[model samples]
Target: MKRGEAILVPLGAMIAGLLVFGLFCAALGLNPLAVYASIYKAGFGSWYSWQNTLVRASPLLLCGLCTAIPARAGMIVIGNEGAVVAGGLGAATVGLATLSLPPVLSLTIMALSAMVCGGIWIAFGAALQHYRGVSAVISGLLLNYLAVALMNQLIEGPLRDPSSFNSPASYPLTPDHRLAYFAGTHIHHGLIFGAVACVLAWFLIDRTTFGFAMKIAGGNVRAARLAGLPVGRLVVIAGFLGGACAGLAGMIEVAAVHGRANESLNAGYGYSGILVAFLARQNPLVIVLVSLLTGGLLASGGVLQREHDLPDATIAVLQGILFLFILLSDTLYGRLPFFRSRTPEPKPHAIAA
Candidate 1:
């Protein structure tokens, strides 16, 4: 698709989604405009709301990258939610273990451990796809279930902090281990990390030889192999790098927000990330903007429930409608005249004979 059409497709899909949502609201005897107003107010009307949106966007940005990167290699990895939990669990364990260490060192350990664990979690699916010929989608999904179950068992069993009896969570990190917030805002440095990761991912995918190879592999694996590309390695590395970003997100969530691993760590950022990636058309840079937009939508859920007397499921319905439209819009890409390649007419016969 042409760049202009690529951009327009998602916008058009979003418009259609909003129309559907409005129709649904009207059917439910509610004012769609009023619900939309509440969404805007809760998401962007004030500095506080902006902060809330950005805070939610932080992890979403990374989780979007988790799926976006591997997508370049034509791999569908949907297990990032599990990777996030695994990463958070790793970070919490490391943070507590390294309590006596210097802040920088402890934080480094926590971040590394989280990334490694998360990377491993998703890489397993990639390996299965390459080596065992298993479907990545199936493996990735099953892995998510396993990760969630494992996280619950650990936190509620061996890893549970006695003091957190009510929550059944790991012990909180020491104050020094926690990430500091930006001045006077609920936003933490995790936002910076997410932004940087997206930028770096953009550069890696758009400017690096490895990224070029991965794109080639994605486009045509047999051709890439004939061209001497390490297709298998590229696929695995893409999955690993994607998961690493997710892991970093988990680390930030635990170290900056929750200060430990808990059920709250499974905040659906991973699942929402898939939508963000699709909306962005898998562009790393665009993922950041899309994440913020989706984050705002998610942030408004509470306001939708409280102010409009709507159920919490309202957001899910909207998201589902949006996702449905996006899928439909995919077929519109090359079919649009704006996206179709133009061919110059053949030159007139020289000098009219």
Candidate 2:
């Protein structure tokens, strides 16, 4: 596909989505223009709003990678929510155990634990797909339910903090162990972590030989196997990397935002990340920009509810519409004459003769 089409097609789809959403809002007796204005005001009108958007974008960036990485290997894993839960559980367990240790060491150990747990969670699905012939998508979906069940059981039973009665959360991290915010800003260091992760992911996928192999495998599994590529290993590794990113996001949520593993850990960020990844076409670098856009949409939900009397699910509806439009746009690729390459025709042989 041409670069212009790669960018323009999605942009056009998003514009169409917005128009449909506007009509939907109009049908509900609201001014579409005012609703859009409110969204912009609440999401990016001020530094405070920008901070809110960035804070939310932090997790979206990581979670989006959960799908984006495996996508390069032609894996359709959608278990980011499960991996996130597992990561949160792992981080909480390690963080609570290492309270006596230095904060830096404790946090580092917690992060590693989270990554391991998350990587295993998703890699298991990949393994099933490769060896057991199970669909990665189905396995991932089932695993999401399993992870949530496990988290609920642990938080409500063995790992429950005595002080967290109403919420049933895991033990909280100490203040020193929690992630610190950027200087003079409400945003946490997680934003930096997310941005750095995106950049590194981009380099890993776009610049590395391993990434090249994965792309070849994704493009044609049979040809890749014929060429002696380790397709199974690539699939598992991609799943692990994707899951590891999500797991880190889970840890960030616990250590920076919630300070504990709780129900709040499943804040729909995982699902939202899928949308961001799709919208960005699974490009790690573009994920950063798409995550910011998604984060803004999420941050504006409260404002929409308060000012326009819209339901909280309004953003979700918009997302659904946008996703549909994006899927439709996929069919137009290579078919549009504007994006097709022009081939020069040979002059008549008779003229040369």
TM-score for all models, in order of appearance: 0.95, 0.96
Would you list the C-alpha lDDT of every candidate in the order shown? 0.90, 0.92
Question: Residue 142 CA error for candidate 1 (Å)?
Answer: 0.9
C-alpha root-mean-square deviation, candidate 1: 2.5
Measured over all alpha carbons after superposition, the RMSD of each candidate to the real structure, in angstroms, is 2.5, 2.2
Residue-pair clashes per candidate: 0, 0
Identify the leading candidate in terms of TM-score: 2
TM-score for candidate 1: 0.95
Cα error, residue 247 of model 2, in Å, equals 0.4
What residue runs in model 1 are displaced by over 4 Å at the alpha carbon? 338-353
Point to the candidate with the largest lDDT: 2
Encode model 2's per-residue lDDT on 232-341: one tens digit a residue. 99999999999999999999999899999999888888889899999999999999999999999999999999999999999999999999999999998988877777
Candidate 2 backbone overlaps, count = 0
For residue 90, give model 1's deviation from the true position in Å: 0.8
Model 1: lDDT equals 0.90
